[model samples]
Target: MTKPENTGYDYDVVISGASLAGSAAATLLARRGVRVALLERHSAPETYKVLCTHSLQACAYPVLDELGLVADIEKSGAVHNQARWYTRWGWIEPRAAPTGPALPFGYNIRRSTLDPLIRSRAAETPGVDLLLGHQVTGLIEEGGRAVGVTASTPRGERRIRARLVVGADGKDSAVAKFAKVPVRESENTRFAYLAHFRNLPLPGGMSHTWFLEPDMAYAFVNDDGVTVVAVLPDKRRLPAFREDLEGSFLEFVRALPEAPPIDSAERTTKIIGTVNYPLLSREPTAPGVALIGDAALTGDPLWGVGCGWALETAKWLAEAVAPAAAGRGDLDRALELYARRHRRRLRGHQLLAADFAKARPFNPMEQLVFAAAARDAAMARHMYRFASRLIGPRRFLNPAALARAAAVNIRYHRIASRTARRPHKVA
Candidate 1:
């Protein structure tokens, strides 16, 4: 709905792209008494992301819990808790300390399940209007600031005026483009392919990852006991994968250490793949508009971070703008705070993810830390915290943690050297 050519507006916050990030922010802000208009281009309620592994990091638990989604997610049969990783050194399984609290677990529900569930939650909330099939056409600019958006809906072209506008659109964000948000781009040298299988129960029913040097593969136990297996190999290996799609996918899985039994399992879905997704980072805020999720930043999906980051970034946006959206504060200051919070929480992880997307072997620090993680349960937990996006580099790669990892590796080497020199028992 259009507003008068003045300070009046239709919504407190008008968010484009009502997927995970947009729905989340909409729900949270509405709960805080802000009227929100959540818009999505896709008209079908069942249309969910197909090319995702659906792994949410443990760090996202608190946010999901606050949304009252954990029980429903669990009821939908989403796998809970830890992921076991395979490195050349060995497996790194997250372990709890002897006398502390158990770590929070992540989920592996399909996007087909998660997207609709969360979207429904937002639509049911008191102050949110879920506008489906509305394609964003442009932004309404007022004095060098975005005042709202114009969209082509099923009805007709509608102009929505709001105090704040949010772009929760995916990696290729139309809202970010319309706002001319400053952006930096990096290229990823790996290509990815993934599919779902049934009756593929993994060891301990946990999600597994293979950090095979420059290549990475995953087997996640999803809802209804289905497993999603994926491989992100160097771009150089793309031809072989494309040449024999099913054969290559199965071969990769079968070659992993203590791999799951995919041979007897039923292929329940088509192999989906993507090549050359750039590592994108855009300035999150400009005047009256803000961006969340992939609109703000999107890195290599090899780490399975998009879902968790989407939810968590929504939390950041809601928290930053709640007061302003409630008509109690300045919207621009809220945007600035949200921008600072976004950078502080995720920029380091973005940098590191971009570095690894180069498809090179692990750096010396990565090698040492990963090797230590494989051997030491504590180190595994520590590294898992970082890998899970629960902690930032400033904490994970600090001198103290590095020193501990170094000490553990040193001990492992000395023991290995002694054992090698001692004997083979003349077997």
Candidate 2:
């Protein structure tokens, strides 16, 4: 672990934190022949983020396939799932569309397995220097622009320089902090609690989510016969959860209509919880520096979009900066393009996610749409697209779509009223 001697502008990009975002960016940049320094605090390759729900939504499938990791992941017994949403009105099951190219299905695998898989691919890439056990302590700035970083490692303190520095770190990012980036946060109204269970009598590889008024619960059937069950309740219910976590978790699960038979299942892991996780957004780009994944935007975990966003933002970064890093374009202009791309893709989604994180009851329009989705197959497809993040909030809630949903709801209520008034024939 001795400090290297030739450390002058050693790499094209020095990425902080070797999580999904950092590793993915390193792989993409390296494959394009750009030198990359990937810094990770965890020395072991197998170590992973333990609190993850381990769900990858369909939106990330193209990136996974492009990275050539999907086949290996499936071989490791990942579950391919389609989500079924349960509302108080009824259950809405979205069928895979029959049109242009089959829609992608989501995958569920433990973080213990998935994280190492991607990191191994990255470390083996041609020009990526995997600097394990390196913790970023501060940013190296020149002329008001980040040029490199100072990190503490087993060897000692070392300085590494690069043309661009990427903060692919998590919500509390050291690189972002050192660079003095501005972050805006919105208060979270609910807290999440979850655990893995075995032998929970549920359908195969299907995600079931129950929207019970203001509270929400989900059971995702995952690999190796394990199911991840999670609940999100308002902060006002914290006392009930703190009293007896196990007992209260069971009580809530049991209360759901047609709930999974968790009582017969064995708990495979200790209950884990995350409290007060606010919706966070930050300026994603600065001169000679950029942020991706949770470092850019951290939304509510109840939506399960974190992993997908991590992969997506990394790919976007590579598309924007790799050419410049390889000496084909201007670095400053590339960073600006990346910033605009980030907002175009995620800004609307982030705003909607922040509002939903408030845990408010469904509004009149939402109720109408949900009821229509339950009764109509076509409407369900729209709901699925929006939930999967395939479509933005503005497109999903357009005037034409809202008018159609209202009409469908009116038709459904008229049919129900007529059926109730009809007399039963005597046998």
lDDT for 196 in candidate 2 is: 95
In order, the Cα lDDT scores of the candidates are 0.89, 0.87
282 Cα displacement, candidate 1 (Å): 0.5
- lDDT, model 2: 0.87
Model 1 over residues 335-363: C-alpha lDDT tens digits? 89999999999999999999999999999
Tens digits of per-residue lDDT for model 2, 208-261: 998876888999888888899999988888898999999989999998878899
Q: Residue pairs in steric clash, candidate 2?
A: none
Tell me each candidate's RMSD, in Å, in order. Answer: 2.0, 2.1
- Once fitted onto the true fold, the runs of candidate 2 whose alpha carbons sit more than 4 angstroms away are 1-8, 97-101
| Model 1 CA lDDT for position 70 | 92
Q: Which residue pairs in candidate 1 have backbone atoms (N, alpha carbon, C) closer than 3 angstroms, thus clashing?
A: none
